[model samples]
Every structure is written in structure tokens, then in C-alpha cells.
Target: MLSTLGLGLLLAGRVGAFGSPTADAGRRGADDLVPARSLQEEVQEVAALKPITLRGGVLNAPPFAIDNGDGTYSGFQGDLLRRLSQFALEDDYNLTFVLSPSPTQYNEALNLVASDCNTTANPNPREECDRFDLIVGDYYCNADRSLRVDFSPTWLRTTMSAIKLAEFEGKGITTLTELTFAGGTACVPEGAYLSEVVKAKFPGASYNDCPDPEACIERLKSGVCQLYADDELALKYRALNDRSLEVTREQFNTQYIVWPLSEKMNPQHSRLLKKWMYKSVANATLDELSYDYFEVKFCPLGLSGPNCDQDCDPIHGLSDRDGRCICSSTKWTGADCSVEVEEDLNTYPPWEIAMCYSFFGINTLAVLVCASWIYWQRNTQQVKVWQPFFLYLVLLGCLVSSSSIIPAVQQSSEGNGNVPACMVFPWLFSVGFSITFGSLFAKIRRVYILFKAAVTMNRVTVTVKETFLICGILHLQLLEGLDSNHCRLALGVDDFCISAMLQDSQHRYQVFRVQVCGGRDDPKTGLFLRAAVIWMNDLFVICIIFGSLMHSVHFGPKKDVNIGDAVSEYARLEKESTTALKERKEKFVSRFSSIDSSAEPDGASVKRHSSGGGPADETIDVGSTKTTDVGSTRRLSAQISLASHPEKDEEDHVVCETIDDLFVEDDQVLK
Candidate 1:
């Protein structure tokens, strides 16, 4: 931004050509943006003080600017000034051209324009820097100079090229290595940036020290230099006037050709210059000026960009060494130069392999501990009952974690490797989970079947034939192994074993969780078919572990004495007490019958049954005992002689007995 000081705007009055602006209307549109009254007055006041413009226009670079013997400038630069003179500065300030620049005088021109040339305390500023205004030239733009001077955005790109004698061939993207073994020397101008590239490529190669582009071309003509290298525009211009020279059809390095305005140039003036030239550059007004100066209808432009097509064209006598196309292209990268990349779906990437190691280690340790626990506690009744189910879990874990100790080198498709993980884990998982879920399910099933039997028919016990099915399945896996392509993940889409062999262990873990939790495949791959075979390996593990831990659903209660057994024992005790009482009564009655003379009274003939109960006979009462026999039932009664309720109603104190106590399920009374 330009400072708001009034004198700065006055110092910024120089008028110079930068680039062209797209006309909102035409060149006359400037009438709409009239300059400030103070600004216009300042431009006029400055112009009166400085008599000559002394514009920093390049003098020696031909076709750009030419110094005719007359006291006026002519060439491409003149035409640029002509276009810019009308609208670049305020209308009242007279714009003029002055001191011409050359390729060799870049530093001098910079110092002169910056007003640092006079180094004294009372330093007098130069006309180009302080008074007359701007300098124009094909200055190589760089950041170092941009700080001291203000250079415009590139008006045009100066493409560099190599020129050879007539009858030379080869047209393509510039090869950085082409001239390295060219078997001869490459001539370049002594002071240009190209000298650095040439020197670096061939440190000891012969160099034709031409002072300028013109000298470089002369050396090419006189056979003093075998190859002449310079900017493409300059070479093409030279080649146009001379018949012996030929410019390579390819373009290589390029530099910026920009208009350099003084740092002291006014911000408002710079903005106006930009507004005017932006359209001119875009619309190619300067290119048109080059065309007019060279008197050619068509001119060349910068060659193919980074995105040039890589289709080597044989008809144009051009070919691609790398993938770059020999002709024009629209897309970037010039991609179709090689066969498509194929990522190994059966192999793990570094990070994925690392994660697999972690999973395998942890799971393997857990499995080993479980197996050890099962082995150590095999005698325990709980362990004994669940031995088959726990065996399945151990085997599945072993398969899941085999890679922990299985070194990569030892792994093979037929043996212990990723192939086995895919091939065997599924079977192992199925077997393990079958026992796991089967046992759990069987418990609930046992309850149902037992209840069903108790109510209707007979008991149903779980058959041990499940082991045979697992054995059959194992034999089936062997059958698959016999086939040539059995366990292969996918012959074409992926190897047999698919992504289980490819994905990280964590991914596989998530996959199993997803399968169990939601019945969905891993969302990452969404490959359910393959994942099914993969997850079926651990399905039982997931079901058993997850159900037991999460839902509190486990196998049946451990076998121990229960309330039903206790009630049965109590029933046996009651029957034994009754037998003891009957024995005691028999002993007493046998003893008393031998020593007594008693009267016998009976309702009818007493039917002898048991000593505890018989017919209603013998009017004698033995300690409140009474008995009766009716049909097939014998009733023995002991009177409840409540001392407190001697006159209780008969209904309340008659008898206490239930049908369950009187008869059992077989319709037999308590023995």
C-alpha cells in the first residue's frame, strides 16, 4: 500500500507502460475515473519540474526496443508505450519516454531508478527513480529485486530454447538430459541464467562465451559454437531473418518478462496502470505488438504445460521419453504412461501388520490361559461338564492367535499362515461356538423338555451325537483341502481367505463384533460374503462370551442338592416315622393281648387289616386312639383334645387330612 503522505503521491507521478486492462468499455473509459483535483495538480506541478521522462525502456534487446539513429525510440517497446500513454497516468500530466535499457545494464538501471546512485548526504535523485518515472526492459524478475523495485505481474512468459543448424530434428518436452551426452558442446550467452544450468550439467564442456543473444547466434553461424541456446522468442525472431538457423520445436525453462516501475511510483498510479494493463495482457495486446514488430501473422506461445498428454505421436516426428505427451493436452500429470497399479489384497500393510501382531499376542495368551485352566481344573465337576464347550473355545482361540508365535518366514498356504487362518479358523470357530451356544441352548432346552415330559410323556435327553457332526465337518474341511482351489479366498477378486488375510487384526475384531452385535458386515469393506466365512470361525466364541458376560445367560445351574431334593428327603423321613410308630404300636399290642381279658364289642364283624387300624371294634379306648375301616380306606384317628376348647364344634375339630397326604401319584397311601 502507498503511504498517505501528500509528497509520496507527488513522487509517484511517473508514467510507464506495464500491461493492458480489459476495457469495461473502450480506451475512452478513463474519462469516468477522473483523477483527484489535488492529484492532477500535483502531477502537473511535477511534470513542470522534470523536463525529460527518461523512462527505463530496454534499448539493445531487438524486436523489443530498437534505437534508430534518429532521436526517437522504435520497436515493440514503442508500441507498448503508445497504447499505455493515453490511460496510464492523469490526462494533464505529459508522458514521455527517455533513457533506454539493455540486457547488460540491469544493475545500473536498478540503482539509477532507486535514487541510490548519488550516495552523498545531499543525494540528488535520478530522473527515472525520483522525477521522470518508470524503466522498461525484459528484466529477469526475482524476489531480491522486487523489494527494491515494483515489478508488474508477468505480461508474457519468455520460454528458453536451443537452436541448432538446419536439418536437425526432435520435437518434444525439453529433455534436461538430452544435451548431456550430445557428443558436442552447448553454446549459451555468458551472463544469462542458462549459463548456470549448462555449467552444472557439463562442468568441463566447451562454452562459447557470447556477450549477448546476437553474439550467440553469430557464433552458431560461424561454426564457432555447435549449439546456440537462448529464449525461444529471441531465437525464433533470429531464425525468421536467417535461413541457416533452426529453433527446436520444444520449449524448456521459462522466465518472466515484466514491466519494472519505480518504488516511488504513486499507489494510485500503479493501480491505474494495473487496471489498464490487466485487460491488455489477458487480451494479448503485447503479443499483438510483437506480431506487428516481427511482421508475422502467427506467433508461438509457451509450450505444453505440466498436464500435457503422454500419448507419444509418431506422425509429428515427436516421441515421449517419459510419460509426457509429445503434443498438446488438457489434463495434468500425463497419467496413462504405465500399467495400472495393483495393491496386494492378501498381504498386510506395515501398520496393519503391527496391529495384527498385537491382536494375535493378546488373544493367544488368553487362549493359552483358558486352555491351561481347563486342563488344570479338568477334575472339577463344573469344568468336567463344560469340558467339550471349553475345548471348542480353546481351539478357536488357538487358531485366532496362531500368528503370535508363527514367524512370517515359517508361514505357508498349506501350513501355518494367513491361509490357514482363513481356511481353518472358520471350521474351528464353528465347532467351538457350536459347543458354546449349543450347551447354553441345551440348558434352556433341558428345562423345556423336562417340563414337557413331566406334564405329558417322558424325558428327552440331549444326544452326544453333536461330536460326530463336528467330526464330519472337520472331514469336510479336509475334503475342501483336497480340491485344487478349495480354500482360496477368491482366485481373481482376491485370494482365497480374502480380506481376513489382508486386513488388520483390529479390523477383523471390529468385523466380528459387528457380525455378532448387528449381523452387519464390517462397514469399511462391506464384504459380507467373505466376512461370513471369516466370522463363522469365532461366532460361537462371540455368542458364548458375549451372552454370558453381557446378557447373564449361561449354562444350567451346577449340579447340587436343591429345594426339590430337600422336600423329597423330608417326605421319606415322614414315612419312616410312621413306620416306626406302627412298629411300636404292634409291639405294645402283642404284649398286651397275651396278658389281658377284655370285652369285645363290635358294630359288625371287625375286618382285620393292620394293628394301627381295623374295623370299629373293642369298645376299649387306648389313650384317645380311634380307628375305622370303610371300603378300601383305613382311617386312624388321634383325638385333638384341646384343653382350652373342650366344647368345640365337630365341624372344626373332626379331621385334618388332604388328598395329597392320603394318596400318592400311583394312588397308594403313604407306606
Candidate 2:
């Protein structure tokens, strides 16, 4: 019975379900069976196999990779690993994370992955070696490390940043340069890549190595180190939790965070891991996980908030260290610096403007009236002597000067129009001053020339056209100086184009100080030039007044000394002498006629003799009287000729009886 049972079991094992072994082998070879299997059967075979598990190295760094101490992990890297794990599961793989046990620094983790632990030649193997298939901590990708191990695609791109105690906030250590120049000690984690960066970039900064990131942070807090350098995101997280800490606004040494995969890792697994990482980036899943851990989103420049949707006002806003908009200028306010602050404009009051306008109007009217009167009296001697053309120019200058009030008021009232108004104001006032002073100077100079000629007894003739030419040349010089110097000077006046809005001590309101033409802060050269021109004009006026006094003293009722004066005086004397001679001749002639007609010649002759001389003898006396009267008239005429014709020889005794005759002969020539 035992021999029969053994034979039956052998037969059952040899000829199993499907066919005999020899028959199955003849139908298909072992290599051919793999291809011959149905797709569903192959899937079932793969499902029956155990999942390919990968061990990932983790660190205690918060916000990047954190160990919960309960055999679970959570953080930016932690969340990223879990998300990658889901992709692995779909493709028949598993991810197992293990925190670094001893020497839990990022460099140690990288070293563990870079070391060969599976070879038999190794005497002792670290537990880290067994656990680390890849380092999932915040490992910076660099050329030195790339030679030691492989790296995944970049998970995060960030820069090195520093953190300090809040007490050192405004100690002029806000920038990396300042911190480096200060020669303060910095706490750098052991084996961190940032050590090389600090040594190379900021050689002046003295750095000490701490055992771990936490130790470095403790050193920074206790004042053992002035600053702690780390990845920007990690420092920002620390600053958010610890109010006593402040992250520097400046960042340095751009670095990329990546997973350092072991060189011995399966090529298939490495490819799948990289594939999923790229997918996560494409779908924004990596960014979403980053936000979940960091509680802040990275935004483009000049933007902030959770969603990065808020815009900072470009003109007046500045972003703070934490990405919030702040008003950069006192003239702006509100959340994003969009609203302008109300300013109390420093300007002339309405009453002042009105008063100025009133004065301008009155002066304008007076100038117009004077100009009109001069025009109407242009042919008169008083107006002709002063040159009516120049007189009108003086009045025109007055009107132009008064018109400057318009722009002055406009600039003060409407600050926006300051530049144009300021430009116009200087030109008007300067041109007017030049015109008026130039005209007055020409008139005074003409008088001075006449006085000089009289004193020197010389004949110097200055025509009206020549006087106008001199005045125009003076005015041109003044106006040219204004155009080249004063007009440009007006442009450079303090706050000429825009009002200076300054915040008061209380910080409630802004004070807007309007710029005026020729402000006190104008250049010294411009002021000096203006003063010099005014002084020259004033000197001319003083000289003119002094010359007039001297001229009156020199001439002093001596009309014959000047031929021009003698001509006028001789005309007056001649008229009076002629009338007196006529009256005397008439009396003599009437007396002679009465004596001839009278019977008693002796009585008549006595009467005539008593009256003056007799007739016959008295007539001879009358003839003598007539001859004496005629001789007296001729002598008076000779004196007039000598006085009037001083330009001719005295022997000629040629007289110009009237000023009109002299002027008619000369045809109104100016002297």
C-alpha cells in the first residue's frame, strides 16, 4: 500500500494541471512564455509582486523638511515627498522617509548618501547609509557636490539670507555689505554649502560653525553670533515665528534646492522621480505645497499679499522686507500709496492778489494816459525836446513792468503753472526796466551833452536819431544779459517747477511752499548783476540832477555867452526898442507940425524947447532929434546883431530878428 501511494503522488506532481512538463516545454520555451502571457495575466503577476520601495533622507529643518517625532514628517519637502509618493503608487512604487539619526546636518545627510554601504569591502556601515536612498532635505545643488552624487530637478530656487536679533534692527546692518564690513561674527551651520559662499563672497565676515541649524539659530538669539545665514525661505519662516528675530532685506548667492540622489540608486527609479518632479512643477502642485508650508507666496517685484494680487503704486510706494507696500514720499498716503495727501499751499491770499491787480490796473491806466498825452503833444517844444519816440517807449516799458503782476499771481495761485509763469515774469520785469531806464538815460545824456557844450564853449550836436541809437544799444545789452543769465537763473530757483511739499512735525498735513520769481535763494551772480544794473541807472539819475544844478549856475542870466541863448534874448530886446523909438518919433513929429501952424513961432519954439529941442532951429533941433533917435535905434540893432550872429564875424553885424526865422532857415535841425 505505501509503494502504491508514492507512485500515485509522483504521477500527480509530474502530470499537473495544463499538461506534462515535457509537453509544455516542447510547446513554448521559458523566454517565449514571457511574451506568450496575456496582458491581464502579466498585470496580475506584477500586482502580486512587492512594491519597489525607496528610502528618502530627511532633516529636522522646519518649513523645508520636519520630523514630527511620531514617525511621520511634514513641511515643504515633506509635503513634496508625499505628493511624489502618490505618483509612485500609480506606477507600482513606494516611498519611505527616514530622518537623519546622528550628525543630522544637511552635509552629513549628503555624505551618507555619497558613501558606498552595500559593498562587502566596507567594515562598518552607518544606519544612515541603510536608510538614505536619496537626501530630501534642503540640499543646495553645486558643482562640488554634483561630483559626489546625482541630483534631482530643482525643487526651489532661493538666495542666501541673514537673520539678526530685533534689537539690532537699525544698527546699519540691513545689507550684506554692511554686515560684512561690520566684521561681526555669523553663525553658520556645520557643513552647509553657505560656508563656502560666505568665505568667497563676504571674506570680512567672521563665521563660526554650529552643530546644526537649531544650534546656529540659538547662537544668533543668545548674541553668541551677530547674525545667522541660511536659505531665504527658512530664515523667513524663523522670523515669522520669532518676533525677536529680523531677516535682512537683502539676499545673496542664488542657490537651487534639490534632492541629492545616491549614485547607487536605480536608474529607473531616478528617472521616475525626476519625471514626477517636473510634472509637479508644470501643474503648480509644487508651488501649492510650498505655500501651504511657508504661509507666504513668492511674487514678482512690486507685488505682495497671499495671492500676490495687490499692486504697489509705482510712483510713491516702496515694498518693505515682508512684501507690503509703504508710502515712500510724504505727499502720498493710503494703503498702496494711491491717494495723495492734502497739502496746505503756501501762496498769496486772494486779497493780496486783488490788491496787486488793482495797483497794476492803476499804473497801467496812468501809463496809457501819459503815452496818449505825449502822442497828442508830439509837435510841442516841451515834448519834442524829450523825444516823443523815447517818451512813448518809457510808457510802454511801464505797462510791460506792470503786466508782470499777472504771471506772479498766476504762479502763486496755481502751483502747476509755476515754471512757465516764472519764466515770463523775469523777462517782463527786466525788459521793462531796461526800456524805462535806457530812455531816461538817453534823455539825461542829451541834457548833459548840451550843458557840457555850453560850459566848454564848443559846438557838439547830438541828433534825436543818434540818441535813440545809443538808448537801443544799452537796452540790447541789458536784455542780452537777462536772456543768457537771469532767465536761466529763474529756472533754477528753489522749487520753481514743483512746490515743495514737506510734512510738518506732527505729520498730519503737508506744507506746500510755492516758488516765486527772483526768490531769495537765487544765485549770487544773478543778484549781483541785477543790483549792479540798478545802481548804474541810479548813478545816471544822480549825475543828471547834479549836472542840471551846475548848468544853471554856469549860465546864470548871462544870455550873451551862448549864441543860442543870445538869439532868443536879442529878439525880445529888439521888439521893445523898436516900440520905444516909434513913440518918441511920433511925439517929435506932432510937435513940429503944431509949431509950423502956430502964429507965435517963439512961444511954440519955447514950448517945443521945453518939451525937448526947438522946431527950425527947432526944425533943425527936430531934425537933430530925429537923427539921434535913428542913431539910437541903429546902435540897439547893432548890439542885437552881435549877440545873435556870434557864429559869424562881429564886423558884419548881421542880425536874426526872430527865433522863428533862425529855425526856418535851419529847417528844424536838432542840436
Candidate 3:
């Protein structure tokens, strides 16, 4: 009876009995006898059994796969898986994802999936036997990994690099070779492919393995490691957010990241994954997805070539957008910065040198001639009155100031080689200015004091010693200038000591027109110091001019008054007038007495009158006449008048004489 049923169904199928409604009634009756299942019913039964759910294992790597803490995931790999799942759904493939358990590092993520199949125990295990059908993250495609799992088409291409604290760059650890030679400890994720590269390339360096990238970074931050080796993309991402971290410019070991599939995964599913990945790559969707997460394109730093295999010098070469090398400084030139540029020595032009020497010579000659003349006229009143000591100082200052031109021109000729000249220029100029101005200020101050004393009738004397003391005080500015120069030399900007190179259109080197003392391109601090010195000198000049004006106005010819001599002569004249007046009074009284006695005739009565009041009256008249005739008193009055109003013609002579007397007195006191 079962054989009859199966044969009848087979016959019904052949006769198209169940396939079309247009079948004859006879065929339909036969199919009803067989009781056959329909195609829709079979599909429903298959669907009811279970869906082909693919378990995808993801590693926790930022910008690749990040767990949302709510059992969801996101990032480049996450978005890629989502899009691949959507594609698979259209083809009846159900895809699901699962993150690696806590503390599952990148190097161990693949092993978690690969270990599930136990292929050694069962060579041909069921497709569903693996813990994960595929693993995704920044899994590098390499021969060692390929033995355990198959890789999908390349998802991302990047190079391996090391990251360190930003300060390490300043320590000259900007390149891989530098880091290796420095013998610093490197933090590497346990079982990471980078460990192999680090070991092979950096034999000089020691390394410590952390459970994962985060632990490695922690180790780096905690000072356990000076460098952390990882993929350039991930390291760059990490460095972008952390200002203290920096990615090394020298990257190596180009790697391709891909989804790792379990060795026991169904071949059909593996084909589907490869097809999807290749399609995404061809359509630029993979790059678009990468941009959605990374938001930046990857390019090896300071590397240039058709395949980015050429390395440019990190110190002297720069890579352009097209990955071609360009020289960053004039010190080097060539495609890869392998050639050293020859620099032409530049010096001051003949005319400038000649001019500087001429000025210096002329100044020297003037100083010598002035000095000789002053020495020859040492005994002259003009020279003595002017103070030979101060005159010599003025000449010395001129000589020193003019000598600064020597160093200035010499420095120009020597470029940055003349450090001593650079320091000497300011010292010479400043000290010279201080001496010259200070000396003049002292002289003017002395004259001002003298005139002031005369005007106020005060006994104030400004001696040569006091003038020298004042000059010495003013010369302290020299020390200040010295300190400023010293500071500039000690803590000056790099450019101050470094000479700049310039090439003309004709490729001719030009002299570095830098003034060692006060260059125009000096740093703000240096410029401020120089400006302060100039302002101080200008202040001195203003003070000198003002003091000179005061001296000239107060001690003009009309107002010349020698208080020392005038006061003494006035006192003498007053005493002599008093003595002369007393003498005349005495003489008058004696003469009146004699005349009264000698009177006769009317004398008896008159004598009585004269002896009493007449004689006294006669004595008073005689005294008045004698007082009028006293020439000494008159001469005393004339002398007082002359002192009060000196003759203009003699004013100059008197001033010269007064100055001479002052010096002479000082000389006498010193002797």
C-alpha cells in the first residue's frame, strides 16, 4: 500500500497534476489520491526548524569596534558588519554579533573563536561547531593567523608605529631608529603581530607585554614603558585626543586589516563575506565607512614614493600631499634629503669695510691729536680751568665709542663666528656714552652750583672731588649695560647666535646684515633692553641740555656775581668807612675846641656862651663838614656800588678769575 502511494505521487508529479490548475480533472483526481505536500508547506516547515544565524565575534578597539555598554556595538567594524548583515539578509543569511568577553585582548580575540571548533578532535566539524563564525576588529592579516582562520578581503591598510610622550620628541626620539638606539622600554599588546616586528627591528630595545592596547597605554603613562607600538591608525586616534601623547613619524611594517573567519566556517558563508567585502571596496563604500569612524585618511609621515616605501629625512625633509620629499631647510637639498647643501661664505662688502675702517681711523686720530694737545697745554689756564682730568675722560670716551665700529664690522665679516665681538660692541658703546655724557654733566653741574651759590648768596662749593664722585655714580650705567649684555648672551634666543643664510635669485649668498649689539630682528626682550639703553642715554642728553640752559641763563654776563670775593670786599669796605668816620669826628671836635679857645675881644662874653652851648653848636657844624670831606667814606660807598653793579666788559674776566681761584684753592688744599 506504501509503494502504491509513492508511485502514485511520482506519477502525479510527472503528469503536472499538482503544479498547474489547468491540469485535467482526471490528473487532479489522481494527485488527490496520492496526498502530496505543497512547495509552500515545505518552505514553511524548513523555516520553522531554525534560521542560519551567524555569530560574529568582535574585539573592543576604538574607531573599529566599541561596545555601547547596552549590549550594542558601533565603529568602523561595527558599521561594516551591520551593512554586511543587511546584505546577507537579502540572501537568507541571518547574521548576529557578539563582543569578546571582558579583558579579551586583540591578540586573543581570534583564538576565542578558533578554539571552539576543536578541528584536531574532529577533522570535519559541523559549521555550527565554532564559537564564532567570524571575528572582526583591527585584525591584521598575516601568515601565522591565516593557519588558524581565513581572512576576508582587506578592509583597511595601515602601517605599524610607536607612540610616546610628546616630550620624547624633543629628546630626539622622533624616529624608530632613535627610539631603538635609545634602548627604551616598549609596551606591546600580548601576542600582537607588532611584537614580532619590534623584536626583529629593534634588537637594542626591551619590551613589556600588556594584556591589551589600553593596558599597554596605561603602562606607558605609568612610566613602565617609554614607547607603545601599535597600528598607526589606532595610535594616531589615541594621540589625537591625548595631547601629551605623540605618534612617531617613522612607521614600518605595512599591514592589512580584515575580518577573521573561523577555519570551520561554512565555505558558502565565507564566499559571501568575501564577495561583500570586495564589492564594498570596489564601490568605495569601505573607505566611506572608514571615514564615518576614523574621519581621516592614513598616510605615513615623512615617507614618499610610488608605494610609500621611500623615507625622507625627518629632520631636513618634508613630505607633500602627493608623498614627495621636499627640503625643509637650506642646509640640505635632494629628493630624499641625502645631499648636504654647500653654503657660500658671505662677508661685508669692500665699500662698507672701507667706510667703517675710515671712520674708526679718523676717530682714533682725533682722539690722539686731542690728547696730545691737551697734554702739551696742561699748564695753560684754559686747560687747567676746564679740568684736564675731565678733558681726558671725554677723549677716552670718544676713542672707545668709535672703536665699537671695529667689532661691528668684524662681526659682519665673520658671520656668527665672532662671539666675543658680538659681546664687546655693546660694552664699548655703552661705557663710552656713559663716560662722555657723565663727564660733561659733571662740568655743567659744577658751573650750575657755582652760579646758584652766587645768585642765592649761599656759601656752596662744588669741588673737583665732588664732580669726580658724581661722574663715578653716573658711570654705574656701564655695569647695567654689562649685565644686560650678559643676560642676552646667556639666555638669548637661538636666532641671536645663529646666522641666517640667504640666496639671491642668482643663487649668490648675501652677507648676514646683523648688528651684534642691536639687530633689528632681535627678540622682543633684547629689543626692549636696547631701547631702554638708548632712552637712558637720551635722558642724559636732555638733562645735560637742561642743566646747560639753566647755567647759561643764571650766569649770563649781566648777572655775573662773584659771591666769594664780593661779600668779603663789601665787609672790608664797611669796616674801613666806620673807622674813617670815627677819625673825622675826633678831628672835628679837637679843631672846634682850639678855635673856641683862640677867640678874643668879644671873647669874654662869647667864651662864656661858647664854653656852654655855642662851642657845642660850633663842634657839631665842624663835625658835619669833616664828615662831608671824608674821602675814605665816599670811596667805601663807591666800592659798594661797584660790587652791586659789576661792569659787563669785566664780567668774563671776573668769571675766569673766579674759576681760576677756585681751582687754585683746590690745588692748594690738595698740596
- Clashing residue pairs, backbone N/CA/C < 3 A, model 2: 614-618, 615-618, 615-619, 616-619, 616-620
TM-score of 3: 0.40
Model 2 segments beyond 4 Å from truth?
1-50, 89-102, 117-128, 141-150, 158-182, 200-204, 214-224, 236-255, 262-268, 281-345, 348-671
Over 1-671, each residue of candidate 3 has an lDDT whose tens digit, in order, gives 43333233333333442244454445766546545568676445434432344566767778777888876677777667666654544454444444443325555566655543446633434433455777767788888677766788898999988888896667745666776788878888787777888789888888898876888888988999888888888887787667788888878889988877777777876787788678778878787876655433323666876667898887788676456787888888888886898765555556656766666676677667667877876765445556678777777766677677666655433355545676777878777776787788888887676655554446776677876687678767556534444332466556634543322422343445645585464333443344344434433443453344335444545443444565556556656766766765575456445434532212122111234443221110111111112223221111111232223444334334534544454345334
Number of the candidate with higher lDDT, 1 or 3: 3
Q: Which wins on TM-score, candidate 1 or candidate 2?
A: 2
Q: How many clashes in each structure? A: 26, 5, 0
Write down the lDDT of every candidate, Cα atoms only.
0.51, 0.63, 0.63
For model 2, how does the per-residue alpha-carbon lDDT over 1-671 read when each residue is reduced to its tens digit? 43333233323432342365567778987676623556576446445533455666666778886778875677787667666655554554544344443347666667777744434533336654666678767888888788878999998888998888887767746666776888878888777778778768888888889877788988877878888888888988887777788888878788888888887788987898899899789989878876666554344666755556788787788666466777888899887788998885655556655666665676666666566666665655444445667667766666676676666556444544355675776777777777777777887787777665655456777777876686578667755554344332354556633443332333343435645577464333443344334334433443453344335445445332343674345555656766776775574456445434544212122222223543222121111111112223221111221222222232222222332343343332211
Residue 629 local lDDT, model 1: 41
RMSD values, in order shown: 27.2, 25.0, 24.0
The local lDDT score (0 to 100) that residue 604 gets in candidate 2 is 21
User: What's the CA error at residue 104 for candidate 1, in Å?
Assistant: 3.9
